[model samples]
Target: MPFTFEPLPIAVAALTFLLAGFVKGVIGLGLPTVAMGLLGAVMEPAQAASLLIVPSLVTNVWQLATGPRFGVLARRLWLMMVGVVVGTLAGTGFMQGGHAEQAATALGVALVAYAVLGLTAIRFAVPPRAEWWLGPVIGVVTGLVTAATGVFVIPAVPYLGALGLTKDELIQALGLSFTVSTVALAAALAGGGTFEAGTAGASALALAPALIGMTMGGWVRGRVSEQMFRRCFFLGLLALGAHLASRTLI
Candidate 1:
């Protein structure tokens, strides 16, 4: 933590969080996704995840708390949240395993799937009646994926999109979900003995840059075309994902 890293890695983290935060600010998500994709390339998945916790948790909490419907959403989404926690706990040991290439490949596949979902702009409709069972199922799948790759946006994001929420509710729901996922991940990491104080410290310091980038991104959201921005962002993810996967396989 505390800038103890070599200048190169320190600078890399500062810039990476800054960029990742900006993307989240603009689009209302993607901080962890971007952070994991980029950082996982340079370090172990567990280490990258450790670096992700503070920044992602802080931002998502802010996102969750700022909403007016927090209590109502909590009541509604509790089942899904419970499932995420359970699934994450169930996946305790997979991420910290000794298989570097396997982890990298898993991360890559997650990225590609996420990128495709974003780029395709595919939308599914979930009737309000279905949330009780469907929500938990989706959460468990998302949690299992998160346990493997340290990314929680797969079926979760898609499932959320299908819920037919108003714009504000959707945003708040994302915050709550991501916040839960982050906490679950922290628990999983701790349980697996992969959590590190240094990584947490460095990730904490990353908060400043992430915040600054978010502010700037919020400002940009009004001026930039979000559709075009999303296309570009997902395209970048796709390329990065392919490289990570192919690099390991080859």
Candidate 2:
């Protein structure tokens, strides 16, 4: 139908997705985090988030499928997932309304905080007994953050990390959590009217480049130093977040 973005911006969006996918491939996360942080610099945060929907859904679904413990994790994390849906639904109005700019600014702040925390050695753990009470709380907060910022990490990621899961189990749990978040965020955006046909088409187009980048990154993962690469990635995110946050100020 009608073109929503010029050729130059489209190219930029494609490249941004590619880069974000590469980061995800290498780190097993950060697709939306990196994509939103970089794309929000060039476009409205809502549009940037909309562009992420398809790729995030596709990749995270793939991630969820590849994990053998999906059934087990799903049973354990259902409440948190439900909370994420409810929270995202509740916050969609503000994200789609006059507070869009404020939401973007909040997203930027979140990015900065996440990057800073990631760069540090800080860690947290959730005792098994606390999951019933704390899981939903964290999920709802994560969902609100996801709705407002289009990034679904923060407390969710840390909370999962605290679950004391094995490396593989942790990865599976993350995949499950992110898949749920992506679906819920898509629903919220649709309800908010931020995800239209044009944006959906653009999001579909971005999937190719993102997948290619992920393939490339997977190849590089075994060859390079993950810790070093992660440090650099967080630093870059910190800078991007600062830029986005500055936009609201200036």
Error at 113, model 1, angstroms: 5.4
- Please give me the total number of clashing residue pairs in predicted model 2: 1
Candidate 1: what lDDT? Answer: 0.77
List model 2 lDDT by residue over 30-61, tens digit each. Answer: 78877876776677777888889999988787
Give the TM-score comparing model 2 with the true structure, all chains together. 0.83
Q: 224 in model 2: Cα distance from truth in Å?
A: 7.0
lDDT of each: 0.77, 0.78
Which candidate number has the best lDDT? 2
**Model 1 residue pairs with clashes:** none
TM-scores of the models, in the order given: 0.83, 0.83
Candidate 2 lDDT at 141 equals 92
